[model samples]
Target: MKTIKKLSLLSLMSLSGLGLAQYTPQWTEAPQQIDLVDMTSFKSISQPVNSEQQAVRFHYSLLGSDQLSDNNQGYLAESKQYWLNTNAQKLSQGLQLPVTSDLAVIRINPLNPTKSSQSLNQQDITVQQFDQTLSVDVFADSEQLKATGMPVSDYTVAFNVHTQPGMLTLSMPTATKALAKGDTFIIHVFEPNSEYVLQLKTSQQQYAANQVVKINSQLLSQSGVNHMTIAGYITQPNGEKLTDLSFQQNKNGDYQATIGQLTGQSLAHGLWEVHTIASSDINGLKVMRDVSTAFALSLPTARINQQLAVQSHGLKLGLDVAAAGRYEVSAVLSGINAQGEKQPIAMLMSAAQLNKGQADLTLDLPQDLIRQSGFKGPFVVDHISLKNQSLMVPVQQLSAGIQLMPLGKPMDQDDLR
Candidate 1:
């Protein structure tokens, strides 16, 4: 009974068209709500440090959103008008960062009564420091408070803060790197989000085999930008343009580099690869970017030539033979000319039986056939077949005195004088 049950289980396992497995959700995070205050700033580190580090300031304003203001009541309705100013003195002392001489205005609406008291008269403050840590100060205008609402009613205004780091660098192995003769290599890049750019550069020699590289990129934020570009040089050993190399990106954001058939008589010995991506600067002038690495090339293999000859006769006409291998020979007897001309001649012999390097053949050329046909010159042979395979050889003209000799036999003579 166990044996029978095992056999039935195997039979069921061999059946096809089983139902597909269930798919699980790939994304789990909730979408972010749009912010009311859009803040953008540029910050950089000062070089050749002095006692006072370069001061960095932040400037921002409240953006009026028809969607956010829609259906607003009480305190929210009166806060949409007028430019909100920051308490820079209090913010500067609290954050311990320098305050710029200029005061930036934060715009707000006052007619909308639904505005919240917390969102009234807001201050936009920017802080500068040499250390990695920094803070932003937000304030609301008290004058924009609604008269009829609860004195302490709550209203929320979303703020988006973006920080741009300076002078970032990234490196990875490039596609142009040579693989060990029979092996393969994958070229790729590591990026935090779609807001970054990747650049790759390579030399001319590496462009020959560009099909082996792969790329993958993903966008993290819905508001982030995606961009890619692939470009490189095709220079010879002496630094000349053998060709131009270009690249294209696929749906997955991988750049495919391509170069047309290489031209120029001279060969190239050295190759280089390079690629670059310039991403959009969401917050400041210093955009996130990355570049693919470069690689050197190895030398190519040499070519080989093969040739053969037999018994000093040059093996002409119906007797032509070719060496297919170290010890294998094939016989060819007939063929057409290049000008579409046909040269038909009588077959004096055919290699009917062959063993090792030797063959037994039969000849049927009679004097009457040759004379009646008035076919002058050596008997021309075009092609020969053996073991279901055939080949053609160059036409060979034979002497009129030449006669067919039997296999493994000496020549017979009409006259030996």
Candidate 2:
């Protein structure tokens, strides 16, 4: 039985050749000590090369702190170097071939003797030859560790070698300002590697409650053009487009438009829909599909401009005119009672010039007319009518001040005598 055991051992050794003995080459005392606390305390050593085949060998030591060592001896009294054939047998049974630096882990417990240290706990350090340089990395168990720390505890360390290529970053542009209803916005995303299709998503806060508004939906072309259409409907009660809506083109090629006059008639109460649709222009045809969000429309107030006031002596006289033009203003004195009935009053004429901001008019009241009518205190100015025009403004509605000047204190005939 002893002879059979010896023969089996010899057969196994012969099959593996003497190279298996060199598989885990032992190392003597290393001269230098490494400090784990210093991250930069790393030393590079050349790996042994196998001439018979493409193989790499790594030998390393883990030293203890000088204060922790007995008799000031290093933590790792002796270390071993391990050889791995890069082109020889496969490291694992299922693997196709051996890589230059394939790492394996082994565990050992110095205190335990019944169990083999190989199965207890162990780490494999691989040295790989890449072109003219060597790469080294360590693997323990199922985890990988760098050579920067000792193997006494569970930790990860990594070592890498490669040429760094230039990098480019892409980012989206910030929104310019608050968007109004029916406004169009363009968004851009930059990428260099390949063309990408992106979909934009907006928050619920962007839309009104219970209102459906279409947000942005569009495809950005490689030319950086975002092709999409956005629109918002005014749904507030009496919501109308603002008057005098205009778009002004600046010297910088920017477009600005005043959202026309808004009236209560155009908008419905509550939430409105403001949406964007992204369409692709296939050939010349447009294919619009996606919709976005619901927005709210607020009611707008009406604006009033032209105003006037008319007064004669102490009684308020309502005057009607025959013609009113852009720059021409005319007023005719007429009689009207509280019942809105026309009474026969002496004909009076007043003239004024009208401009963009304000219209100034002067009414000369004849003393004879005032005296004959026995007009009394503080007369109110009634309606002011433009000559030959339909834009007749009521005197009560006029915002400008109206002054009644008594016709040049009727020239005294006695003074002339």
| Candidate number of the best TM-score | 1
Q: Which lDDT tens digits does candidate 2 get at residues 1-417?
A: 898767776665453332111111111221111111111221111111111221111111111112111111111111111111211112211111111112222221122222222222212322222222233323243143324344432222223222111111111111112112222211111122222232333222221112232222234445553343323233332233322212233344222222322211112132333332233443443323323233332111111122333233221222232112221222222233444543323333343323233334444334444334443322222222223111221111122212333333333323332
Instruction: Compose the digit string of candidate 1's lDDT tens values, residues 13-114.
Output: 432111011111111122111111111110111111122222221112111211111111111010101111223222223322111112212222222233
Against the reference, the lDDT scores of all candidates come to 0.27, 0.26
TM-score of 2: 0.16
Worst 10 residues of 2 by lDDT: 72-81
Where in model 1 is the C-alpha error above 4 Å?
1-225, 229-232, 239-245, 263-270, 275-277, 282-301, 304-417
Cα TM-score per model: 0.21, 0.16
Q: With candidate 1 superimposed using the best TM-score fit, by how many Å does residue 254's alpha carbon deviate from the native?
A: 1.4
